[model samples]
Target chain A: MADVLLSAKDIKIRFGGVIAADGINLEVHEGENLAIIGPNGAGKTTFLNISTGYLRPQAGTVTFLGQDITAHLPRTITKLGIARAFQIPQLFLDQTVMENMLIAAASRQGYPSGFKALSRLPEASEMERLLELVGVRSYAERKARELPEGQRKLVDIALALALKPRLLLMDEPTSGVASSEKLEIMDILTAALAKEKVTSVFVEHDMDMVERYAHRVAVWNVGKIQKVGTPAEVLADPKVQQQVIGI
Target chain B: MTRRIKPITTAAVIFFLVSAVAPLFVSSWATLFALILAKGIVVLGIVLLLQAGQVSFGHAMFFAIGAYTSAFWGKYIGGGDILLYLVLGGISSTVFGLIVGLFVVRYREIFFGMLNLAFSMVLWSLLEKMFPYTNGADGIRVARPGLLGFVFTPETFQYVILYVSLLIAAAAFYGVQRYLESPLGHMLRAIKSNETRLEYLGMSARRVLLIGYVISAFLGGIGGTLVAIIQQIATPEFGFWTKSGEFVFIAILGGGAHAFGAFAGAAMFEWVRFYAAAHLADSWQLILGVVLIVIILYAPNGLIGLRQRYRQSGKRGR
Candidate 1:
């Protein structure tokens, strides 16, 4: 009976003829690691977008920390302690990793300009800690564009974590990382999430990672949740197995 | 290029010494002073616009606004008293900047650049069309601007006026540089790089750009006002598209990222224009075009890039 941090009721999103997300109800509790696993085009990303304020649902009410943030601006919603990372790992490529994380922290603190932050020592140290947490501390001085795929993903996660957010919406955090490196990155992410006690509803295609990391698995099919339960329960459901897993 | 020690210090020291003693070389103190002051002011606006990776092609409109404000006030009310003209000119430019920024900052990339040029040209055309009050092509006269109650008729006194104004502009440039290094400026760079990510971070891209736009315009207005006072005329030419192009050209000629780049660019721009006009006359644009093309191709960093390369070479040579 944990307190819910994010609660969405009957959310439906349509893109002309295609319904990206349809009548879905989901909740992520405080300090919980929730996974939304689905096949391609299941509207997993759209659901994440609606929850993070990037996309507005046609019908739904989203309450985060008991506040109705459905109509709030994306920046305002982020300020309310919900942070997200894109699947493609968006970063200021010309900037140093330290500079990237520092800006992220400043944005979270509502520092309007970089001149105001002025590369303060404390901010620099905080950036170092974030980099270390995400296992990219050695790459702090490197330009973001120079980093490899795995490190870039870590930097993206570090930026989201820099916000010190209570809830994180991650889109394919492990996407593009080598198959061997996926578990390592997930392990680092899970440890950081645990340390911060941050709740997350992340989308991933890897079932093994989901089973290993997800506290609760929500299987989505055709923009709707097919089942929500412990890994074993959801994996056992015949409808979920046939429609979602196709096993 | 690459950062080094010895050569950089030597170059900086030489530049500083030359500028400090430059006023002594010219017999006409007024020309020397006016040359530095006017160009320095214009460069301030260019610096601000370049911060967000934007090239403003219509700063001349603000310059024209400032010049007109000073001239209109100087001619009618106070005869262009130095103090009154500058204040009035700054205020007018600030207001115009806020208005134009509202419309211009919404556009991005080439569309943003094009809108600025179009807006400036519109102002120029309007000023020329409403010739009855603006004097159209004839231009407007400026009475000798004064300090306090004393009018500056002496060449030495005019020198003081220009020098003081130049100092103020320099200080303002420093302030802007400091602002650019702040968190707000970083976000602007972030916006330039990936605005979508900024939106995801919970900040509006447009609003941030608007703030930068208005600030740049305010500086542009200040430059225009200085030019009006120095030239003693306010014309529709001040708001011309070519004038805006001049600012963009100067900004690019100077490394947009460097604090002093715009100033160096402006000084070089004015000097080159003077040389081209004196020597090439009708073909001056051809020479200017060649120089621009060369810089764009080989040294895209402009003067700053050249300096960096020179220093790096010196280090390697050693």
Candidate 2:
């Protein structure tokens, strides 16, 4: 197996008597796409929250590249080489797609200060290249609010990728996208992640995407990882088939 | 239609020169223009705050801080150099801004405005109730400050303040326009758009807000100092809640997020009020209130947006 890039040990969280994550331990190996599949309220995103520093787990230690980042801030985690793409596509909607990329670029350059020309960043070409990688180069001049849903998801990912994260966490990359466009978004996402050689952990509901993109599958059920295996091993299980995929 | 910086700047320069020389021709309007220019600086600060979707309803506290800093300096140190007063006054307000901003920038929308209002009210009460030191409601009388080392008489002082206020207003307007095009400016817009994404990008929104707040405070302070110099006194009314309202009123009247709008709004606000008070003293407030309502309803984006709409439609017509 590849060396672990991020390890979460004994994670626990509860929100007003409802346990979101409890005694959950998972390891994401370097340079592999890990899919987390769960039903509603299973805390797949909660795990992402704890990992990304949005939520500090009540009990757990999350270490990334040998650093204990369990309760670190989201921005700190991002600066420490872990970046997240929101399921709802959090973006600077009024700004152009290229401007969004430039913001991401500016953030990486120490949260940006001074009167440096935004349109003429030194890494402007690099921003263009990243947009091209995510297939959003054509919409670079377009406002983020004007992009279609699928393109919004792609740009969100592209913005995350601009941080040059060693490990990328995505909370349902295709949640709002049309079903007809799901596979296309997944294709672009997978291709981009593969090219970037990033270790990714994504919570997904689409079995087709999970089967196609994920190297390993972790089934989350009520604050615990019930099973973890290769996609074939996990998806083939009778319980997983019944409880998760509902096949 | 396009914002060609050089032409606008040249025009602004000419406008300022005209205003500076206006006292030579139309001396009665000079003081009025001087007051407009000073308040214009304050509105520009509000414009910067507006760019980040923030409106400091209590910003007059900084204005008062600047005003008071100069008053206190004149009272204690007897420093008359205009540059010294401006520097000290701006620094004093900026320091207070940094302190207040550290707390207020953590909030958003109404909370931010209320918190700023609360702080300014505190300053206002201190100035009003503290009779021993602050001189209560009568305010502190300040001697006329000088430019360089020359003691300015009333004759030279009016021209001194008029030209100085015009110069600073032009610089601030141009600087703010330039700043709005910079990366940090874009970051301010990003904060307004989605702070969550800003953080995930490894930047804190609170930190960005604090910086903007500090800059706004600095501008407000400078404006206060200029106005105080022109008035030759610092009063509790400087930090009053309604005074802050007037700043917001001017900001909206001028424009939202457009630097030029702030100046235009200040000019219109002062000139209209000055003339209307003389002619229609009983109903001037009513007329201005009606004007604000109309602007909010029809031109909600403010003057700049109105101008842009006309220009774009004119092009379409062509």
How many Å off is the CA of A56 in candidate 2? 1.1
DockQ class, candidate 1: medium
lDDT of 2 at B60: 98
For model 2, residues A1-247, the per-residue Cα lDDT tens digits are: 7998999999999999889999999999998999999899999999999999999999989999999998689889999999999899988999899999998998898856667778888978999999998888999988999999899999999999998999999999989889999998888888988898888999999988899999999999989899999999999999999987889
Q: Model 2's lDDT to the true fold?
A: 0.88
Q: Candidate 1: which stretches are off by over 4 Å? A: A111-117, B1-17, B28-33, B310-318
Our tally of clashes for model 2 stands at 1
Error of 2 at B206 (Å): 0.6
Write the residue-wise lDDT of candidate 1 on B1-318 in tens digits.
Answer: 124324433543454345545666764544544655566667667766666677777788888988898878865676546767777777888888888888888888788888888988888888888878788877787666777777555666656566656666656666776776677777778876878778777677788788777777777777777777777788998888888887788778866766566666776776777779789888888877887888788778877678677768799999
- Please, what are the lDDT tens digits per residue for candidate 2 over residues B184-285? 888887888898899999998899888888988999999999899889899999999999999999999877656877877887788789888899987788
Per-model root-mean-square deviation over C-alphas:
2.6, 1.9
Error of 2 at B22 (Å): 3.6
Task: Kindly report which residue stretches of model 2 are placed more than 4 angstroms away from their true locations once superposed.
Answer: B1-18, B312-318
